[model samples]
Target: MQYHYEFILATMAVLGILFLFTFFKTVLPIRRNRMFRWLLVAESVTLIFNVLSTWYNSSFGQVPLIVINTFDVLFFIGFVSRDFLFYCYIESLVQERAPAIRLPRFLVWTVVEVSLLLILTSPWSGIVYSINDSGYHIGRFYRLVLYTNAYSYLLFSIGIVLAAISRNVLARIERFSLIGACLILVVGNIMRMLYPTYLLMDSFYMISILVMYLSFQNPDLYIERKTGLLNQSAALSILQEFGKRETFSVFALVLDDFSENRRLYGVRQMDAGLRIIADYLRTRYPDCFIAYLEEGRFMLIARQVLPVTTMCRDFDRRLQEPWHDIHVSLYLTASYVAFCGPLQVERPDIFLNYVATALRRAEEENQLVVIDEQERQRADHDAKIRAAVDWAITNNTVEVYYQPLYGTKEQRIIGAEALSRIVDPELGMISPGEFIQVAERSGSITQLGEQVFEKVCAFLAHQDAVALGIEKINVNLSPIQCRDERMPERLLAIAGNHHIDLSRFKLEITESALADRNVLQNNMKRLQEQHAVFSLDDFGTGYSNLMRVLRFPFSDVKLDMSFVQAYFSRHNRLLPAIIDGFQSFGVQVTAEGVETREMARELTRLGCSILQGYYFSKPLPEKEFLAYVARTQHDPEHTIRF
Candidate 1:
């Protein structure tokens, strides 16, 4: 029996030394983690108290034995406090960005401290344990008091896991770790009470601690160190775990105008703002779990659909005041796109992707945009158009369709505007109006514009334009082309390579393009110097300052079809005056969409210099447009609608 006691002591000794070695080896920079620090203190105090109690249990002298038993009870009382501390550690590990479970901290601690006070002062009263002549002996209510307190801590630990799961906060692995740790202690404590003589409870706690160390310690890899929030990978894990069910809403929050802030304050100052943002979310959004996505981006998961009206009000209020916690005073705004789930989304990646798309649209328009059926269809359409445009650009199959710009005075095809048409073998013909927006958004306009210009050059090289009495060929320039610094050189090279005269080319720009007067003037001057003409296209469709646009060196301005058709009956309102003003400035005016010969006769009477519409010819392929030009120029008596 003495040898049995010695063997038990040796086992405790071995375990004690092992814990100390592991502590020193694995706990570097451990002070930074409050959870691990609480855990360390709890385990250390428990290990020391348990070892001393076992050794001094059989000491001979009654005085020493009484003191030892008292000291052991003091340590035993301390274990009750450690139980709550252990629960605190676990709570911190699983808390994520918000409160996981609301245990009344004040009430729980009060009950625990009161229980501890009873156990510590038990020697005098012998309510928990008493020292006697026979040996250290147990009090009558020992197991009841001990277990009741221990079970309270167990209840807390279990509460955290269940709350996290029901809220859809934890991934599968997180659920496994938390549940496994609680089970180990629960089963181990039952065994300890059943076989009191055998020392199994401490070993069970150590095993649970080991499980937790492996589990919670990995958070460093997935958490943002600056703000202590989960990063994208962990956020994605939560989404994957709960995306299919109808448990929660995921929100994508974009920091609007973040680039402007970064430019003004620099990166260090922006980081300070971001940290404050993390803290702010923790307070204001008490029920949401947050993930630190890329810079100026964040993901928030909550138990139900967000009150969009409330959030919008808050958003407005936040922007109305300047916050001072950052490096400088800052006013900010955010775009919130909610992922309405259970019915709309079927998978995590799809939910995140849709949220991203909605957020982008909101940011672009500087407003709140929802991802509904219309938005989804628009996204799918844009994607298809983008893919078809990419394939068209790669294959060099982009075709140029020419609409004849007939000089009404000549009553013949004098020139034509080169419009790009995409005729794909797979998708068939894609309208210019549909794919042009896609090209602009994707920044593929530069490539697509160059290809169209090349196709126009190829067409001119194939046609006998000078022999066919052509004055010029107009090519539409996108806003993206207007901004490109290399536009003049690239266009000149393509025309020169095709041996077409630059004087026979006209570049049509929108009225809005002239808003940037300086750059547009520079590019236009360079092209004008090379003997090319500039025409303002779709003139009255914008806020056309006719005087302001004529001030630029453009030789012609095309009248928008809407104004021409609107004034066919009501001709004296503004159209006649606008056309006279352009012709007086030596700027030729062309009226397009002359669907009726009545519209054409009225525009010709209004002193419009040129006419273009389906009444003369719809936009035609390269070979057919040249044929019409050749046939009309030769047959001077070609029957006019007049």
Candidate 2:
């Protein structure tokens, strides 16, 4: 019974290189990767023990009986353990993709326990192998153990194929690689049994592992090359594995206004700064899972409570100094949002969205926020609102409500302001302010605006505004809507579809819409060409610049309700002067929030041509608004008294 060692040594060399690559490249502590690494260890150990056992058996006359027994027993244990580890690796891979498909743990462990017990008792009972003074010999149950091992491989291959067929989440190449590994092991065992003198099993194992590595385990998929931190995919993989059951803390550091920074500092310099930040975090928290989420954002995850305050302080302090070698003093502001808990969402994507919302909120409020129950509720609510918005727009459930605007000179309802309203069956009347903000943030504002505009067109076409003494209907536009290059054409097409005149459409825009003056000006000019009118709404809110207002062709400027309320309640002198200046520029001043007749009289005296508030009418559905206009036209005292 002579054994060849050349093929065995060659296989060991290849496996050694493969094991090192797998060990060093696998940075994420994800369950699947960990299982695969353990499988590699088992393979390496089994190969070494097999080589030792082979050498000792060749020198059976010279080597001690105890050493031969020890090496052979260890080799068998390692051999059996390799199959189990491969099974675990496959199970973890499937679980990561489709967590529902779990194999029977009790059945697997039962088989493993029995196999290990038989191997452990083999030296005394000689059930698996025997070492007589003549030579090493296979015992009675050796063939049975080999059959069982081959059966397990066949079972694993079947399981992998079944799981792959049932779940589309597993990649095709991954499924094939896994199934191929099992089949390769089984075939290698059969071939070794046919040719007892040839050492082929270890070589086959090496080939199977190489197949897996080439298919999916490439380090570049998960590592961010520039920053040397795990990339977004790696972060997501770790989160998906532990998000539902594990309690951990996640700290997100997002660059404030990342787009602006990218534009200002250039992409290369910003990337250099990101690398510096990554290095700082990686050095400070060596044990934590650090991921560079790109766009000047990094995520730090830890299983235990972290010194968040100390870490943030040190992070900020380190960032104050200019990036080394880059030499440019890049001042990057970072928003911090931290939370420690089991993510309640069912999927990793939802959890990521919730974290992103928290980060954006932190950036907007300019504060470090620890996400608590209230913040979680807010995130959930925003998610629901986003869903509701999508459903409403998709189902055409978005309704338009009109609030009448009163003409001071005529003392009649001259126009109305179109507002969007969403009434969820469960949530019931979501606030316009809240839903609008959610829609804008979720990038659904343009679609929502289109839906509302189309509905308004339908209302204007069906209802006779001239018959009701209505001159125009004001529709509010968000900054995001105005930035769209096709918004003007979309609005005109909607109005044309309904055979409505564009002149009767006074598109109201908030001061924030002035952020991109060129886009707004271009859209405004295109709309005005078709006889549409423009009005600056929310005049006294953020970034209120009168000179910026004059950049577009604005027919009207509505004083924000805040300014109107301040003027009427606290005698805000600035409001009156601002109104006078806009009026003098030949822009009709429409005072919003004129809730009382006294306030209306004062605003009219202050030369405001149009007054809109609850004093005239709260925003009403199409039927109610039309009826109110008709009633006011017949009863002039209705406007003065009501």
Candidate 3:
């Protein structure tokens, strides 16, 4: 019991030191905030009262009886007055618009004042706590005094929580801490009431105030240092509060070249520039709360939508004039993403993503601001595609279609091209070209590649390819997949697992992708060592002409149909020479889109050994393609007559 008293004294001392440390830790903020100062003084007074009451009661005869009694009375008054002081502090924290304070302000405080009047008169009736010549003794109704004050505050607190339930507009962490401290206070008081020998209510009430101060009262935790704007967490918290309203908009501004400017100006000078920018933003929208997100990103909360186009144009007009300070002068490009809401309250991050992505899309497209119906529609469409692709990948519903690639000289089917297609029960037949990029963007391209490859390999394994004279089945690997270091080996593993030889499958890489031979070149080389064949696909479409083609270690080049169409329209005789040149370089040439029998005959004469087009067969399902193979072998030359 003696050591327990020492611990109590020691804890109170530590609590005072904590308050002092927090006070100095955020000296500038505390200096500006008088209510916060009163909070500290009130807590300190209550702690001093507790320590004095403890000593007065214990050393009853050692000290003067009257002095001890006076300490006891001051202790009870301090204990009771703190509740009103804390209520004022809490009322200040609440925003004026909050519904909890809808009641007449003076009326609420008046009731608390009358309760204090009853508590103050308790000393006369000896109801709260009393001091006699014997010692300081707990009054008969001491628990009533503690509960009445606590429950009154508790009722006010509950009103605040319910009012702000839709969004945490209040000092949420402090509110939570207050609730927890109240619960503990109630529990501690009930236990002490059950056993009248113990005195725990004062210590527990001290805890209630201490919890709020430490958790939510610290400004440094939520205020940005350089700009003094609400920090990232505070900004988001307040934004959620604002989001609860019916109509609000956010201007998500990203200061372009932020890191570059930081590098040029140095950290300290950059901070000064940011403060200037933050101040400018505050001036522009004086009533709005501006939040400085990390690395030159800032968000503004506006209760109503503004003309985004006009505002952004002015932003550019002002910023383009050049920002000049003592140390740095530069032109800064800022991008804006704005969204008016009936926001997606369930998914708050998505609401932000919609706006932030518009800014990114605008900057990327070299536009000023791209927050229009089309941009939002694109985001929604992409979200649908992502969800569809995710479902296809999960359910293994991704279908592989086979288009037959034929040898011109052999006049029979030589290989089939495998393309993954998605025909969602709802989204009906999504083109791989469209969804493949979606997969890449969503970082599910690898899974998509593996899914397609598994189907292709399984199809090949199921085929009587040797009997059909089908030497290989060409598989298209997305450029994103090719960039993966393990993609080649991973694909080889898939083929090996399906008991399909690497030689029986050819992975097609776009000519544009192969231009950077310094790239996934090693991945291809590793695959080549394992006898996996590679082909340059859509050869003519890339920026680089024969230069990328010559260095590429492809077994062949699949000419794009565009060249065939061009040849037919323009009657370019050079197409024959191009084919011969490719063949001479030891890369086999294949003519794509060989629609007419005449085109096929001409390509054969031009030294192109293979032809692939809808003329032979459009991309067919697995069973249909196998039947096509049988039909092709029987009448290869006459399948499509000139």
Candidate 4:
């Protein structure tokens, strides 16, 4: 008995030293987790009592059983309190909130503490111990005390398990850490039950230390590096767990132009901007978790309904506030989708996808749009458009239609622009704006553009090319095709094989196609060397101001339809300035979308030499365009007013 007492004292002393070391070591890293800190303090107190109990039992010949039982009850109380604190710590981690140490609200904590106090003070306290016949004190109610201890530990274990499952606080790695801790506790409890020894239970303390160590090992365990919020990887894990037990609504606010801003401001400045937004959100919604999904986008999940709406409005307002010394306007758009009731979303990825789709639709409409049933219908329409585009690629469904370009002075057919026309025999004709982007995204535009160019070249080789006195045929180049290095060589080879003059073919490239200046310059130089005239199509639509016109090697420039639409409006000053700027560069100007005879006369007064618009004809098929050109050749002064 004396030897057992000495061993227990020595073991308690070792545990006390280890606990102190762990407590000091964890304080700095986990200082924010007040609940965890309190748990460590409670654990230290429990170890101190165990040490005192061991000393009293060993020093005195007839030590009071009540004193030993009192220490046992206090130790058990400490264990339960620490276990509850562990659950609170997990809840804090998952919520990405700093844990606050608050007095227990439920009757459970009061009942346990009060029961412990009563058990320690009662006369029956000695029931846990008895004086043996050989003048030695021994634990008598070992089975009963063990059962009570097991029940108390079981309550703590169940609380932690419930917290873990309900809160979804643990990541995959954290979950494994938790499972390891539970395993150690289970093994320690089993050993205590079988051997009736306290030493075996102390072995599990090492596992708790390991669990703490593991928790701190993850660099982004608490905060994200990118946005200074909880990362998506962590937030998604928490959301997944939160979905299981409770009914909460989720709303996402995405920032627009995050990447462009990042590029403009540099990485450090962008991160600082993100941190500012994150901190603002954290201060406003203490319960909500924010994450940076991409450089220019953030995902915020909140429980409160009205607060989320208010939060989104606030976020947009803050984003719109101009950054110091930055000339760019802070244009931000946010789209939100809420999930409630029985339709619970377990996967964050799917929820995020829906949010992204809603955001894209909102941006397309260029307004603050809410995702409703109509938006879902729009999404369905988009999906069908995508499918149609895919079908067009596989089945070679896209066709090329010719529209004649007549000389204003000659009134005869000069050339034609080969326009892309997708004729779906089953679904009929789809809009160019609808499937053209899809074709570009799917990399089918390269193939489609080449096909159209080949067809235009083939038509020029036939007898129809000679009948109309076609001097040149204009073929519009897709931006994707313009990027291809082989495009100039391919066009030249096709012209040479057909015995067609390269000088007779005009290649129309949009202003958007000149985004990559180096690629554009190289391709333009190569094609220009082959005597193929280059025209800047839809010239003024993009960032093509007068300065761009001076830089680009264009033989002809087509003014955009928007400029022509407002030609006679109050903004008429810009049209003359644009034409003067192009004429100064010795570039022949073509006015697109000239509908009325008044608009055409105004354009001619503005010194626009070439005209192409509905006043002459809408885009016509090959035969109709040829006939229209023949009729126009006989009558140069014919005025068809729209």
Superposed Cα deviation of residue 115, candidate 2 (Å): 12
lDDT of 4 by residue, 188-210 (tens): 66776676534545546545644
User: Cα deviation of 444 in candidate 2 (Å)?
Assistant: 2.6
Clashes of each: 0, 0, 0, 1
Give the runs in model 2 whose Cα sits over 4 Å from its true position: 1-21, 36-94, 106-218, 223-232, 241-247, 254-276, 292-297, 315-335, 341-354, 357-368, 409-411, 486-493, 516-531, 569-572, 580-586, 640-642
How far is 585's C-alpha from truth in model 3 (Å)? 4.0
* Poorly placed runs, candidate 1 (over 4 Å): 1-304, 309-338, 342-370, 569-572, 635-638
Candidate 1 per-residue lDDT over residues 162-241, each given as its tens digit: 88788787778878988998898899779868877666666777677777766655455668776767777566556654
Task: TM-score winner between 3 and 4, please give it.
Answer: 3
Ranking by lDDT: 2, 1, 3, 4
Q: TM-score of the candidate numbered 3? A: 0.61
Q: Tell me the TM-score of each prediction against the true structure.
A: 0.53, 0.70, 0.61, 0.55
Candidate 4 lDDT score at position 417: 73
Clashing pairs in 3: none
Over the stretch 381-433, how does candidate 2's per-residue lDDT look in tens digits?
Answer: 88898999889988999999999998988878899999999999878999999
**Lowest summed-lDDT stretch of 10 residues in model 3?**
26-35
Note the Cα lDDT for every prediction shown: 0.74, 0.82, 0.71, 0.62
Error of 2 at 628 (Å): 1.7
Tens digits of per-residue lDDT for model 3, 77-196? 666566656655555445322424434667567656665665567556777767666666677877676667656765675555555554665465656765685576567557656754
- The prediction achieving the highest lDDT against the true structure is 2
